[model samples]
Target: MCVVTAAREGQQAGCLVGFASQCSLRPPRFVVWLSKANRTYRVALGAPFLGVHLLRRDQHELARLFGGESGDDVDKFARTPWRPGPGGVPLLTDACAWLVGKVERRADWGDHVGFHLTPVEACADPLPRGPLLCLSDVAHLAPGHPG
Candidate 1:
């Protein structure tokens, strides 16, 4: 699992993203799919940059905070420390690794919207410890939205 965050018009949004991966090696492209029913997708539509965060196993609480809540009704970034990246995307300081990407395209994929982004900037500091968060760990988690 991964966490995707974006900022637009003074609002910040993030969610636990499971349907995301590198799709093109030639162009260094990455894609994160967000449900159409999700609030994040709506905010991301107008965002110039989107941030992808790798969560360490011990950071399950971070995942829960993003995955379990919707930004429409809550300020997910309020309690977190973050700064704007290249395109003004909110990047979390506690992530194992994070990347700021320009949204190259958005495609409708059934109930989810696929956000394909090209990495504009990236940072990696070797994770000191703990495994990356996995899908199984959040199987029982519920999204803040009814969607």
Candidate 2:
């Protein structure tokens, strides 16, 4: 699982994502699918960049915050430690690994939209704190928005 963040104008939004992966190796491309019903998706539609944060196995609370709480009624950033990244996107400080990517393209795929990305900046802990948080780790979380 990952948390994807975006900013457009002065508005920022983020959400937990279960559908994301590296789709290319040569040009180093990645793809993250955001539910059309999510507030983060709405903000991302106009954002030029995105911050993808890989969660640590121990960060269940963080996952719950992003995955189970709706941005429509909550300020996730005020509850977490983060900094403005490239293009003013929020970058989670507690991530085991993270990257800021330029939005290359977007495609409609049923209930979700796929954002194709090209990495612009990235960081990884030299000694990871734990294994990556996986889908099973967050399976109990109810989505912040309708699917």
Candidate 3:
């Protein structure tokens, strides 16, 4: 899972997204699926931008923080070093690579909703490119929001 962060109307939210993929290549589109029950989903609903972070294998702690705890109950940003991005979206300082994607569209799918993104601004740390954290890496994690 990768962490997705967004801010709208001065409220910020982040979460571990299990379903993300590059859906298009021409215009460079990506999709991050957020559970309707997840707090981030609520914040991202009308957000103009979304920050996508690719986590390194060693950053399992970050994965746990986003995937295992609910933002409604815990202040996830309080534990991470993040700053506001282009549209005031929160960007993680330690992400292997990060991108601020302008929300092109949002689709409602059963159980989870999709945020379609078109890359706007991005950065990648070239020095420490490592193995990416994947679904199997944290299969034991209890979701912050099961729905």
Candidate 4:
């Protein structure tokens, strides 16, 4: 699982994303699918960049905050530690690894929209504390936006 963040026109949004992966090696590309029902998706539509943050196995609470809560009602950034990244996107401070990606393209795919990204900046902890947070670790979470 990952937390995806974006900012546009003074608004910032983020949410827990389950559908994301490295889609290319050469030129280094990545793709993240955001549910149309999500507030992050709405904000991302106008944003030029996105911050993708990888979580650690022990970051269940962080996942819960992003995954189970709606951005419509809460300011996720205010609840967590983050800083302005490239393109003014919010970058989660507690991520085990993270990347700031330029939005290369947007593809509408049914109930979700896929954002193709080219990495602009990235970081990784030199000594990872633990394994990555996986879907199973967050299976019990109730999505902020349910289809």
Report model 3's TM-score to 2 decimal places: 0.95
RMSD of each candidate relative to the true structure:
1.1, 0.7, 1.1, 0.7
- Candidate 4 achieves a global lDDT of 0.95
Give the alpha-carbon lDDT of every model: 0.87, 0.95, 0.91, 0.95
Model 2 sits at a Cα RMSD from the real structure of 0.7
Q: Estimate each model's TM-score.
A: 0.95, 0.98, 0.95, 0.98
The lDDT-based order of candidates, best leading, equals 4, 2, 3, 1
Q: What's the residue-level lDDT of 2 in candidate 3? A: 87
Clashing pairs in 3: none
lDDT of 4 at 114: 97
Error of 3 at 21 (Å): 1.1
Best-performing candidate as measured by lDDT: 4
Poorly placed runs, candidate 1 (over 4 Å): none
Query: Sort by TM-score, best first: what order?
Result: 4, 2, 3, 1
Which is the better candidate, 1 or 4, if ranked by TM-score?
4
Stretches of model 3 off by over 4 angstroms after superposition = none
Model 2: residues with Cα > 4 Å off, grouped in runs: none
